[model samples]
Target: MKIDELHQVFLNYPRVCTDTRKIKPGDLFFALKGDNFNGNEYADQALEKGAAYAIIDEEKHTGKQKILVENVLKTLQNLGTFHRRSSKAKVIGLTGSNGKTTTKELINSVLSKKYRTIATSGNLNNHIGVPLTLLSIKEDTEIAIVEMGANHQKEIEFLCSIAEPDFGYITNFGKAHLEGFGGVEGVIKGKSELYDFLIANEKGVFMNADDPIQKEKLKDYINKYGFSTSDTKYYQIRLVEANPFVVISVEDTIMGSQLIGEYNFTNCCAAVIMGKYFNVHLDKIKAGLEEYVPSNNRSQIIEKNGLKIVLDAYNANPTSMYAAIQNFTKIEGGTKVLFLGDMFELGESAHEEHQKIADLAKELDFDNVFLIGQNFYEVKSGFKKMKSFDDLKNHLTKYSLPNSTFLIKGSRGMALERILELI
Candidate 1:
């Protein structure tokens, strides 16, 4: 069947589910295949779970409720793109090496105050995820915050072709996904694709004036934002403090946020600036920023069992891990105990980068330091090394550090947050 026909069917159902286990009655199920599993095999299971239609690409699975397509993933992407083009909502496409998700959430929080909005769920900002997010955009949504993430060059450009955003923002470039993107230079070229999209399309840009790289890249662009009262800046915001939460002064107003760390300060500033650009009142913007709270183990502070815990285990790379360590050291309280987990996706640079992180940790004056993961095993540091979280827990079973402040962080796969159960 044609894409138009499939889109019509999607319009009728208006819900997309990839997992049969999560499928709801009347939802459209896409049999998407992944590295290890073939979703075509689960097409019937999706229908049995009450999905209105099971979109399949395998000819053998095609029949009755199972709608056959040439390619299941490609079909879903097309459906998402088709839905995006048909929407009247103004789209904001954003990408970066770091802070993309937080910035997306901040923008969504601020914009949702004045406009009906939907953002990319969690970290679903990839090839399949972007389309899923775009397809989720409702007819009444005034703004769509489509976040695009990439490890290699041109990936953002491809996502842009699908999202076709009216505006763009690139949260600062950082060292991440080095395995997929060739090197640091590759990281820059890859993330700058968002700027390329906006510049090529003549769409508005939300530039950060405080960032010299952003200033240079967006120097030719007119639309911009930052923390200074510059002639070229569209909005100005100043960071007051970022201890346990972000506190900012925006023009005549002061906003205190529930988010933590200095990295998040930029994220909040971007939101306030974008809110003002979209004509949202400063008061509403402040309220929205204040209402927003950090979750999913990204910059969350929990005090329990007389110990202060900083959980930032959602993800980690060289740049973000460095920033997290910098901020964790500054917080004044009980004895600081840091559990630094290995940064992933460094590829060939894993050893060197992990050594750098170990070196940085030694330079810092923390009370106790414990390093986990195989990447850190060979790194020379004064910090104690644990092969895994279980190893750390085994040590803790013999000895406990109560009433001490702890910074627990690692890549998502590390599950370092489980350390909370011990503390």
Candidate 2:
């Protein structure tokens, strides 16, 4: 069936499902295929589970309730684009190397105070996830915040065409996805695709004026709003301190947050600026920021058995890892211990980046540092290094460091959060 016809069917059964196990009655199911599994094989199961329609690309799966399409993925994308164009909600497309998920959540929390808002759920900011998020927007949604993540060139640009955002924001380009994007320069060019879209379409953008690269790249864009510490022309906010929790002063009001790390200052500032732009009351914005607590091993502070722990193992790269360590240095207390794991996706530069982190850890004033993973183990460092989690687990089980402040961080694959169980 054509897109318009499918859209008509969607208007009746608006709920879209990808998994047969989660199929609800009167829901439209899309049979998405991957290398390991073909979703077409489950079309019959979806129909049995009461799916209104099962969209599939395979001709063999065609039936009374099964609709055959040239490509199921493209059909889903086109349908999402079609629905977005028809939506009354103002779309805000967000992309970046680091803090995209956290920034997106912050913006959503602040904006939802006044407007009927919907945002990308969790870290569902990829190709399939973007379309799914757009499809989830309802008619009553006044604002939609879509987080876009890219590991290679033109991924953001392609997602932009689907989301068709009226406003855009890039968190900051960092040494992330180095293997997919060639290097730091490639990271910049890849992320700036959002800027390219907003500029060409004459859309508004929210930016960090404190960043020199952001200012230089957006010099020619006319429609832009910024937040900074010193620039009075835009919204001004200052960081009071980040001892364990972040405290900030904005609009003559002091706000305390549950989030730790000075690097999160920019993330919080961006949310405040977004709230102001939408004319949300300063009190409501403060409430939103204050109520939010970091989760999913991202900058979470936990006190257990007299030991204060900073769990930041959700993701890591050279940029974020450095900032986490630098923030750890400022916290005043007992013996500061760091359990740094290998950062992934660095490609050929993995060894150098791991060595740099090892060297930096040596120079810092930490009482103990333990490096985990193969990359860090290969690096020539004096600190206690482990090639795997079992090695670190065995050592930590024997050695007990009481009343110490622990900073545990690494990439997602490393699963450094497991250290909490050992401790």
Candidate 3:
């Protein structure tokens, strides 16, 4: 189909789905192909499930708007680019090995207080997700926070071509998706695609001055909202302690939030910088960060059965595990218990990454450590071996966990959160 014709459908109504499972009324479903299943096979099912149109490559599908395309995925990408160019919104693309989602949410939270904002929702920050996010933009969207994630060298470059961010932020480079990215250097190369793109496009870059590696990569971009690098174009953050909230000092103004940890403080700093550059008032920026709470299991504080649970177990990599450990150490607690689980998708570096986390746990001086998953086996063998996951569950049942703060962390594959249900 011609670009103009696709625009007539896409511009009028968004290209919304590929799966019939989640199709909503009036949504345009694209019959995309995958290894196991052909979306064309489900075209009729999508229409029956409330999709207004089913876009397919197969000629057999019949419906009101079941138009055929040579390739659905590429077609969606093209349509997304068209929609992105049609909008008046400024886009800020964010990508990194770790903390991309959290940072995207933080930036969106701060930016939304002053402008009509739309951000990448959930884990929708990949090739398919990026296009979906772009097409979701509406006329009122003054700003779009696009989160891009990649595990291969050229993935970020491909994503950037479609995203074409006006400004950008690379949260941090860490050990993640090592299978596809190769190693730390490959990780850097994959992530730096964003920086390279920003430089090529001549866009402003916001970076974490605290991270030496990230700072070095974007050395040419004028730094914004960081401390210690005051001469390097930065924003200062001084944490104020009080009851259940933290006071953040930006310049002369002190802003407060219920969030804890130096990592969150840094996350807030990035948001403040993004907001300031857009001319958002300091007070509004404060409200935005303060009102915004961390989502899912990342840095969430929960109270269950008289025990304070720090459930940072939504997903884990070496970088996030370290952050959670550091954050846990800073809090005043009864007895600190570490329920560390496996960090998955490290590929060849799995052993080394797992051991590094074990070393970190020992350095933190935890009262006890509950290691889970096969990856933790080597760590347990080297460090003080804990009883298995089965034994730990039994221990929790027989004995009351002391008023100690419990830290549950691991990659998504480990399902470490299951301990909560058993407890």
Candidate 4:
């Protein structure tokens, strides 16, 4: 069927679901395939679970109340693009190595304060998720923030084609998904795909003027924001403190926020600058920044058992890990301890990057540092090293520090947040 026809079906159904178990009545289910499972196999189950219609790719699954497509994923993407074209909302296509979700949420919060806004939910910012986020926007939505995540080259380019955003931003490229992108050079090339799209379409980019890399790469058609308004081309902003939580000054306004990590200062700044650029009132933008809080173990400060824990274990790469460490060391109170795990998907650079973090810990002279994961264990550091969470758990059973502040961070696979139970 044509995209227009599919979009009409989507208009009537209104809701979209990819998971069979989560299908609701009157929802459109798209059978998406992946490495481990084929959603096509569950198309019938989704329909049986009250889906208004099942869009399937396999001919064998096509039947009553089911629509067959040449390719379900592509068709769903087309439908999403069609829906986006039908709406008058301004869309910003956001992608980066880190801070994609946080930045997106901040932008959504700031925009929603004055306008009907929709954003990519959680970490749903991929092939299937991006399309779904676009399709989820209502006709009344004044703005939509489409978060895009890519582990390899050309992925962002492909996603941009689907979302077709009017504007774009990259939240600083760093060492992430190295195994997939080849190396640091590959990371720059991959994330810059957003720039390619915006430049090609004659769209504007919200550039971080303080970031030399972004400055050098995006030298044209920019919506700029960063420290130092002395330049006039940039919006002035400053990092207050993220030891307890992120605080920032957007020009004359000092917005105190609940987000932690000085690294997050830029994320909040992006929202404020973008809000102002889009004509959101300064007061409403500040309200949005002040009201927002970080969750899902991404820079959360938990006070328990007389110990303050800075938990940022959502995901870690070389760039983000160092930023967290620098922020923690700057806080000169209580016994400072470190609980860092492996940085995954670095390919051959994994050992070197993990060692680099270990070296940073030793150089910074934290009271005591604990390293987990095989890659970290291989590093020859004086900091306490453990092979796994089980090993860390066993050591924690015999030792405990109650008064010190702990900084816990690692890749998602490390599940470093679990250490909170023992610490």
Best by lDDT: 2
Q: After superposition, how far is residue 224 of candidate 4 from its true place, in Å?
A: 5.9
Every candidate's lDDT: 0.87, 0.92, 0.80, 0.88
> Which of the numbered candidates is closest to the native, going by highest TM-score?
2
lDDT of each residue in 53-121, candidate 3, tens digit only: 888887777557688888889988888888889899999999987777877887898899889999998
Flag regions of model 2 displaced more than 4 Å: none
Model 3, CA-based lDDT:
0.80
361-395 per-residue lDDT for model 2 (tens digits): 88896899999999999998888999999999999
Model with the higher TM-score, candidate 2 or 3: 2
Question: For candidate 4, lDDT tens digit of each residue in 1-423?
Answer: 888988888899999999998999899988899899998899889988999999999988779999999998899888889999999998899998889989999999898888999999899999989999999899799899999999999999999999999988889889999999999899999999998998888877887877778888866554434433345667778776665677787767888888877778778878987898789998899999988888899988888889988899999999999999988987655899899989999999998999899999999889989999999999989888999999999999999696899999999999999998896
Tell me the TM-score of each prediction against the true structure.
Answer: 0.97, 0.98, 0.92, 0.97
- Candidate 1, residues 1-423, lDDT tens digits: the string is 899999999889999999988999999989889899999999888888899999988998888888889998889988888898899988999898888888899899999998999999998999999999999999898899988989888999899988888998888889999998898889988888888888887888887777778788888776545555454444667778887678998886889998888888888888987898889998999988988877899888998889988989989999999999999877877888989898889999999999998888889878899999999878888688988888888988887786799998899889899988886
- Candidate 1 vs candidate 2: which has greater lDDT? 2
Where model 3 places Cα greater than 4 Å from the true spot, the runs are 62-64, 221-232, 239-246, 380-395
Question: lDDT score, residue 376, model 1?
Answer: 89
Task: Candidate 3: give the clashing pairs.
Answer: 225-235, 226-235
